[model samples]
Target: MQGIELTLQDEAATIELGEDLALALKAGDCLALSGDLGAGKSTLARAFLRAMADDEALEVPSPTFTLVQTYDLRIPVSHFDLYRLADVSELDELGFDEALSDGICLVEWPENALAALPKSRLTATFSHLGDGRTVTIAGEAAALSRIERSLAIRAFLRERGYGHAKRRHLSGDASARAYERILVAGEPVRILMDSARHTPGPILQDGKYYQQLAHLAEDVIPFVAIDSDIRTKGFCAPEIYESDLDAGILLIEDLGSDGILDADGRPIAERYLESVRVLAHLHAQPVTRDISLGTITHHIPDFDRRAMKIETSLLLDWYLPWKRGEKASDTERTGYFAVWDQLIDLMASSEKKLLLRDFHSPNIIWRGERSGFERIGIIDFQDSMIGPTAYDVASITQDARVTIEPDLRDIMLSLYCAERNALGAFDETLFRRDWHLMSAQRNCKLVGIWVRLMQRDGKPFYMKHMPRTFSYLEVALQHEALAPLRDWCIKAGIL
Candidate 1:
């Protein structure tokens, strides 16, 4: 592993460096703090610990007495003193093995356990340098490379006037996107979206990955284009601050954390009604197929039959087989397609409007201080397309991630329909018919998506929502229009 050496002039500089390291540190990482007693090993380690905990006054007492101190910070952390240890073998009794896998570790006098140290660890040796101290960091190649990338991000932030910003991880979502909040000294906190370039999968159809087939966004361009469109429409979408299109990085305004869901994790009817009104207003306007992106033209895609089928097919490919513990046969699969073809065709016949594919509680933020529809801060619409407006309404009212109680859902649907019908040109009858059909189609896709997320992607959290999704699907399946498909599901025992 290569080493990177830097000198910190004072205690503040030392703490700042530690905070920087804290950004890249994850669970299972080790910061072997090594140096003489007065060389500031504990100082650097304590600073790192405090930053991770987000509490400057956090007690980071030396582990000299206890030999190890564990803190339940955002990322659990362990501080160890090996000098007082009788034997390296005693580490097992101390649960060091489990601790390493559980959180970040900072070990002072790590040389005492040098023979037992994990090979994937980072070692920081501090030494006196004039009035300050020199900290040299060395680690496995992969770890060091990650450190370098963190350093690069720091530089990128500095150039954007966030040199002294306090970076906080906002974690990740189901997609490949990563987010961080950068709070500068006086400026409003900004969000840093780290969307890595998507690696295209094997060419299964017409040299495209599943994302391409589904018309899903592959990078940050769609977000930028969509954000501009939403802002131009006088909505509450976050403003883009600075962007690096090639690097897939965007520094944008931070939408406050006040979500529409209440303490019970259910949507507040008032806020959800406001969102429905927002959709009603949007659908009533003239639709724009084109988005102005400087020299680039961003054309919103149509939610075509191929994309619809590709999504619905996930049920056959993942959920059904997983439920039965057996793969679907050609005949069964063909029958599944036959049922979906009718539903897809019905949805295709509906009038086209801008469909924010993921319109739901999770993507909607409640801005109570704002006016009317602007109070609903919409995010995560990069996969939006020109399709049946009913699709978005169904997604919100059915809400795969959060349960929309049937009664509450009825109120929401009624409010949405009332608002939509107020525009004398809209057809309430046709809209109602399309809503049930689209709801069933969307929920059908979510069933397979949740299953695939668990079985193939190793993310089981979404699986918890499958029952709620299926419940919504059942409600829609009961519609007279979906009777054929409902019968098919019953025959397959997937109902």
Candidate 2:
């Protein structure tokens, strides 16, 4: 969602805002705060705690030394201070997980737990602005939706001059009408706007509109949220003016029709290297407590044992039938299932890292310049996860629709590996081994996914990419680590 830039008149306004937030919070919620030492971090915390329960003796001390402190309230509350932490691992001793299970957590100096925190939590950053302060709040789907409701209520209050509206228009009809007029007529409307439109596709699954909207916003809105900063630093995306996460809409600057994939059907050597470099920079940015993997995991359903089994079944139900034009024999099917199981186990054991699950050609828009390398603009990155690094590398090199030149692919991989080495400890040999293994694993799962998209979802456009996807699988199977899968595919006559 787009961040609202506000200028508070005084600490009273800040405390009032915090009290309003406290009244709105529920159990299992998280609010991460970041700002300089005296920017009212503890002041806001005190205000929130006081509002939760009338415990005047509640010693809401600065958690600078303890790292975290918990207070028993009507709803459990945990206050954390990472100002003294040396690294994220230091949080392990504080029983943070237990707190997350049944409390509303308010964290101060959250940067210390950046890597280990959840991806879908709320974040509030406070900064001094002259004699007052500026606070920016952001969160995942549920949290953002909650905040949106609160904002709507606040807007209603302001509209009636702090008096009540005779009848609240909470059905969001006014909002929808406002958006339509602004979008279709280009008439200036007070709400956020965007250029993207809904085209023919699968009716989004039942009970998933908000989830999907959140996903879309996560992917698209952030470009506008940070567009100016990114552009000044030499990156290209869209410029976002406003976003309402609760309404599932965004007002963003449109990057016109010349995407990199639209300009070049196949990735060239220079473009590939440049793309990899951009990814390296993105991953290398100092992990901020403001962003974390914790929130993403918390919002999306986890791949539990049952979900994994169901996903594996797709190979038999969709991919095999699509590829072979007939049902697989029991023996052949059993072997394929075994290979899938083994790959899933390997993936489960690997170390997790940030992965933009859909990194590929079509998502990279080409904003042309003499420097062909840096002209690429990235999109469709909201589904990024704290998964294997190789997942993203493989997503690009062995892309679904376009075939990356072999020489370019190798060069890009080498550049990525070297960059990783420079940043942290990495075993080059082991990294490459895992990279190949994960590549094979990703392609196998994707084969089933694409087949399901075509057969079950009636999206045949995805089927057009099967030949290129198969080529990636073929190369992956050649690696020694994936020999069992290679042999299994061959024996089943599906390689």
Candidate 3:
């Protein structure tokens, strides 16, 4: 898509452009504004700040003398005028890295410090066009595309000479795919897209297998199944109007704003209990049929035991370094494997139930209504299998990153056990022992996964959660059932 082009004829137009840009600004965004003196750079910056901060009268003076001005908005905003800098060394002294790490930055005369600035920074060049000016914006192709869309939408409104207001929204690959599939399938669906990136893959389909997967998904997921048969007596997921599973495409119902995760993005207290209930409901139904896992893992390009071991070795490789601030020795590595072997054995002995292997925070949505806990919506169940219940429970309570409050965790565990007892399949003591064992195992695997995310996938965001995952493992090791494993971790120096 082409980048957005805007012609500013008056102060109102400039402010309108600022508002448009504000909608697209995210944390850590850098905007380089280049223009001659009196090009209304400060005026445009003021408008952008006002749109974000909601304070129209906020002062935004030129940083001619100071070189940089900072503003505390919904997120941090930095205004820099490199026009006055004597050398790039001045920027280094001013803590430029600290500012960019936390907020959006606006730099005027960025060329003066070009060598020292980030390569990915956005550039907005302003030039005098008759009484006003022409603004040319360039940045990452995706960001530029958004700037273009905003300009188009703004121009559409301006032609009508009426002010427009609406809640700001951002679209990701998943959302774009959802929209594309709906268009192709001729189905109406409501989808709310967010900026979070959980899994890695394309979000839409352009081929036959993807279309077939979408059709199969529509058949299996409960939401669509319920719509097909009104007599079906269960809360399924909302009908997926369209999907392209191969492409990660989906056009689904808006499950509303009440997700199982709290407002601060933490998993809600009852989530653990609700997840177990869902698993019980699924497993209660006799499996009088068969199912396939998927082609991703099935079609092994080249499966070798050594290769698999190398891939799994990433747990000790990356996680141990980040956690211990050093790499594991030969003896320590052997101990790690021994612990994993024991945990796997424990998992094998547990009673098997249908397992959503990744039944963790991101996969669940909170419905908030409180009718038999049907409020919880499940996603990412394509990896579901017939496995032990402890696996799913471990995925929820001792999540790799998000820490569930102890009080809530205890309450939810009690609720799940009680529900199983009411259903005549209760084994509280065994469940407790298995729960700790599984939690320790899962966290161990997560430490590896998180490390892989950073070093292999080139995503460092997961690294920040390493300490929490280590802490979970530490607590799990302290349990009486996990005493041996705890000692092993200590011997390996992972404790």
Best by TM-score: 1
What ranking of all candidate models by lDDT puts the best one first? 1, 2, 3
lDDT of 3 at 28: 76
Candidate 1 Cα lDDT to native: 0.84
Candidate 1 — which pairs collide?
none
Tell me the number of clashing residue pairs for each predicted model: 0, 13, 4
Reference-based lDDT, each prediction: 0.84, 0.63, 0.62
Predicted structure 2: lDDT: 0.63
Lowest-sum lDDT 10-residue window in model 3: 174-183
Query: What digit string (tens of lDDT, one per residue) describes model 2 on residues 1-495?
Result: 445445667887777676657645677887889899789888889888876665435667888788787888778999998878897777778888789888898888888788777776788899999999999888766676556555564454445343121111111210112111112234332223322322334443344442343243223333333343345445565555555434344544544445445344756556667788777665554322223222322232223333334444556667888778998788877776677677657666554554556677766766565354356676544444455567678887777778776887888889988887898765667667667876776677678878877766656677777888788888888878788888987876777
Cα RMSDs of all predictions?
2.4, 21.8, 8.9
What TM-score quantifies how close candidate 2 is to the native fold?
A: 0.50
Q: How displaced is residue 97 in candidate 2, in Å?
A: 62
Pitting candidate 1 against candidate 3, the one with the higher TM-score is 1
Superposed by TM-score, candidate 2 places the C-alpha of residue 234 at a distance from the truth, in angstroms, of 9.7
Instruction: Please tell me which predicted candidate would have the highest lDDT against the true structure.
Output: 1
